[model samples]
Target: MTTTSHSNRDLRDEIRDYWSDRAATFDNDPGHKISAGAELFAWANLFRRHLGAANGRSLLDLASGTGEIALLCKELGFAVTGLDWAEPMLERARSKAPEVTFLQADAERTMLPDASFDVIVTRHLVWTLIDPKAAFAEWRRLLKPGGKILIVDGDFVSRNWLTRMIERFSGSTSHGMVSRHQDIVARVYFNRGARSEAVASLLLEAGFENLRIDNRLSAIHRAQAHLFSWRKSLLRRSEHRYAISASAPMTTKE
Candidate 1:
């Protein structure tokens, strides 16, 4: 398939179309869910531990495809809202968890109220976004003071020749092959490299503070990944460095 060079809007359109096409089969794909493994389980356990407890808080799951992460948060005692652009994905999420709220909305331009959520979680959505810097700014804007944001996604662990062959052979065995392969291409197009420092810098540019990168694999998840957790701080310099222009408002922390 030929991918045209795209501007930001063009990229968003492509992503929206791509997800819309695959929305029905989104969950069944091996790429969507984490499989069982000691490393994955331990990682999830650690992630939960780091999150403290959801306990009656409100969570906004941005780009929540099948509501898996949102449901997890809901199970942890959060009143959860699953938001995504694809209607079919929301439908599937609602079917799986009728009690939770699932809304069709763009991750970059959601119709959600400002400063509404206590926690914002996005799984594998960053790579799908055309303007992640803007998305992160929006995530910061939607969060209450000191609210937490967790982004769980892949990282560049060196791929060996054998790994490549195994991955190629295993492609037919998983749905994630398509989504993830596309993501790798997109990442290379958007960011020159996949490094914690590069991701952290982008977060900082988007006004996220106290950035931390957590890389832990356990038996509970299928993908070995990297997670970035950051807090919004209530401080500012005279001028925002990464803002699009002087007209754009600086994101107020909290």
Candidate 2:
């Protein structure tokens, strides 16, 4: 599908380039890399809560940067395929876990088969969408009947004064980043970062059912708490992070 960005200019190339350039340094963020420790367990627990038993089910990870979540799902016993538009990102992911399949492709239009996966998962991805409605519809097409999707993301653009102050005192994700990061952010569809409620409504309109939004990522937050200063921790608590889990219909909707 032709994706129309907020500016009505195709910003896909710019977005891809931005992430690709950051591929080398992407895992430096505590939350980005899940090696081992409480962080891994916390993430695993969250997935288990949402996905039930993996049981070797076919799972797809969209925009699977460095394959952190993809490898995590693999560890959880899911047959996983990760797709990312950036080759640098896929290269990192492939090196981390050669056993897991990593494909270079666009998440918005994966060019995969219909009903190809039992579960679909993505993190920090939805907010970058050029056309989220189309993306959600495509995800539904990719999932099997009764399949589930988990969207873990945050409203990074819309920060409160307290959160801003905390970030100012501590370090922000913008630290040690290029100017293009903000540039891409400004052009993406969710430029203002329309929190989880907006995403939930988009999913409903896309015909996904059994929708649920989780505002508290307390477990994951606690796991990575050590990485942040007290002020940063407060900022974390203040940030509009969330997960929205929804299931594809048991039967096709007209």
Candidate number achieving the greatest lDDT relative to the actual structure: 2
RMSD of each: 10.3, 2.8
For candidate 2, which ten residues in a row score worst on lDDT? Answer: 1-10
Give lDDT tens digits, candidate 1, residues 172-227.
Answer: 55566566556545543344334455566777787776666765433333232322
For 1-254, candidate 2 gives per-residue lDDT tens digits of: 25534344447787788789889989996678875888899899889988899999999999999999999999999999999999999999999989999999889989999999999999999999988999999999999999999999999898878876775676445644546777778877799995999999999999999998987689889888888667767877788899899999998579
Question: What TM-scores do the predictions have?
Answer: 0.72, 0.91
The segments of candidate 1 whose C-alpha lies over 4 angstroms from its true place after superposition are 1-6, 34-44, 156-160, 168-193, 221-254
lDDT for predicted candidate 2 compared with the true structure? 0.89
Q: What does candidate 1 score on TM?
A: 0.72
Per-candidate clashes, comma-separated: 15, 0
